[model samples]
Target: MRNKVTKAIFPVAGLGTRFLPATKSVPKEIMTLVDRPLVQYAIDEARAAGIKEFIFVTSRGKSALEDYFDEAPQLEQTLRKAGKTELLEILKSTNMDSGEIAYMRQHKALGLGHAVWCARRLVGNEPFAVMLPDDVIAAEKPCLQQMVEAYAETGGNMVAAMEVPSDKTNAYGILDIGEDMGAMVSVKGMVEKPKTGEAPSNLAVIGRYILHPNVLRNLNRIKAGAGGEIQLTDAIAAEIGTEKGVYGYRFRGQRFDCGSKAGFLQATVAFGLARDDLRDDLETYLHELLAARKAAE
Candidate 1:
């Protein structure tokens, strides 16, 4: 039997250089999508997937990210006094129980593999999940939950895969396919940011992952690959053809790369339109803006 994936590692150490002035004061993960922070979306997804322990690999200037999960006693008391039951319930969802979440500091800005490696001791020998807060997915069934269910049936290293344009393959860890099995594919190899026209397949690896502990072990002896940073894809790629091979899962959702400015704005608009309270007014404003742009053109 495969060990259940009860723990999840969230890599939140990256300095959000892209967002600049806003990120200077606020960690990117604390930036709100609709009303909830990016990290909150990740935490909610993990909770839906039945993850027990939440491990965050962080760096300095991430105290706000850590504090976001802490309970606010005074705020809760005030809510109770005002009889704001609905608002109190929403606030309570942000509080993480003691011992349920752990934080490990990544002192250097090495790479994603290094950040994940920071939490190796905490993950122990069990299978664990890795979630990137920047890649938020909007799905009826959360993307991580989808992968966790699939992991139960096929117990090797599983990565969330999506088909990107062949021209854009250089931007992702492209997969070399062994067999194309409907929703899942048997992965023969993984290439991180392959040069143009050298990509094996357009099916690219995304942020969500359910990995075996051996991948972490691979990181222990890993040399820097690709962009001179410790790439997590290199570590996971090492597990391609062991007894339990690596597999790619095509998750059901629209993924937004929230790390980029364009993607962030797109996600905000998309998520805003999805809300009952904001949809009509937001939709009308969007149509009016488009019409005005067209008139100017």
Candidate 2:
């Protein structure tokens, strides 16, 4: 029987160079996505999927990220005294229980594989999930929850996948498919950021993953792959032909690559439109802006 995946690793060691001055003082995961921080969205998704423990692989300047989840007792008490019940309730959700979360610092600025491997001791021998806060996915059901449900049936290594234009395959880890199982595809191999005209397929692996513990064992080998950094794709691909199962789940969601400036702005707009309070106003403003641009053109 496959051990239930109850722990989740969040690789948030990135320095967020793209956000420049803003990230200069703040961790990118703490940046807001409409109203909530990127990490909060990820935490909510993991909690929805029955994740019992939250493990964060952080870097030096990320104390704020850790503190964000800590109880804001003084603030909560002030809100409670002011009769702001709704706000206080919202604040309460951010406080994680004492043992529910753990943090490990990634000393080097290594790649995603290294960041995940940093949490090895905490993950122990169980299969686990890895969610990158940068990939903010908005879905009817949270994206990770969908993948967790699928993991029960497939029971192997799973990565969230989405179809991209063939030309754009070079920008993502492209999947080499073995079998078509509707939304989930049996992954024969994963090629990391394949060169143009070298990609096998347009299905690209995004941030969500349900990885077996063996992958961490493979990461222990840790030979630097592409770009002289440990690549998670290389470790996951090692499980392809072995007993370790790896699959690509075509999750249903709108994924925003918050790591990039343009994707960040796009997510802000999309999320704003999705909100009942902001939709009408934002849509009206966007339409006027488009009309003005067209008139100028």
Candidate 3:
């Protein structure tokens, strides 16, 4: 029997250069989506997926991200004194228990593989999930939870997979598929950010993964693959022919690449519309904005 995936890794070391001025003072992971921060959504998802230990791979200028998870004592006391039970309860959800979380610093911007590797000591030899908060996913069942259920059946290694446009395949780690198993596909190989028209398939790897520790070992062998960075795709691909072969699971969710400004705005709008209290006003405002733009055009 496979040991449960009780640990999860969050790689939030990126400089968020795409969001520039806004990220100058703020860690991108703490940038709020509607009301809650991106990191909160990721933590909720990880907890829902049965992750017992949380690990964050961080870098410089990320103190804000670290503080976000810490308990807000003064604020909680203020709310509690005001008889604001609901609000106080909301604040309580954010506190991570002692020893429940561990943060490791990634001194250099080596890449995804290196960032994940930094958490190796804590992870040891167990299977762990890696979640990229930037890829905020909206799903009936949290994406990682869906993956955990899937992982139980196929225990080697699993990466969340999604079908993207054929031309857009170059932007992702395309999977060379073996068997067509509906929602789950057997991964024969991985092509990291393939050149235009060089992609073998349109099924691209996403940000959530149930990876074996061997992938961490593989990271030591890879110097750099694409973008002169140690690509996680290369490490995962190394498992293909080994005993722990990789599998691609098409998750049930709509993922937003919040690393980009446009994607961030889009997620804000989508999440705003999803909320019962905000829906009517947000939808009305969006319609008015569209009408104004069309009138100008």
Residue 237, candidate 1: Cα error in Å is 1.0
lDDT of 2 at 272: 97
Tens-digit per-residue lDDT, 73-192, candidate 1: 899999999999999999999999999999999998889999999999999999999999999999999999999999999998999999999899999999999999999999999999
Pairs that collide in candidate 2 are none
lDDT of each candidate versus the true structure: 0.95, 0.93, 0.93
Model 1 residue pairs with clashes: none
Return the top candidate by TM-score. Answer: 1
- Candidate 2 overall lDDT versus native: 0.93
Clashing pairs in 3: none
CA error at residue 33 for candidate 1, angstroms: 0.2
lDDT of 3 by residue, 173-264 (tens): 99999997999999898999898899889999989999999999999888987899999999998899888789999999899999888999
TM-score of 2: 0.98
User: Pick by lDDT: which candidate is best?
Assistant: 1
How does residue 100 of candidate 1 score in lDDT?
A: 99
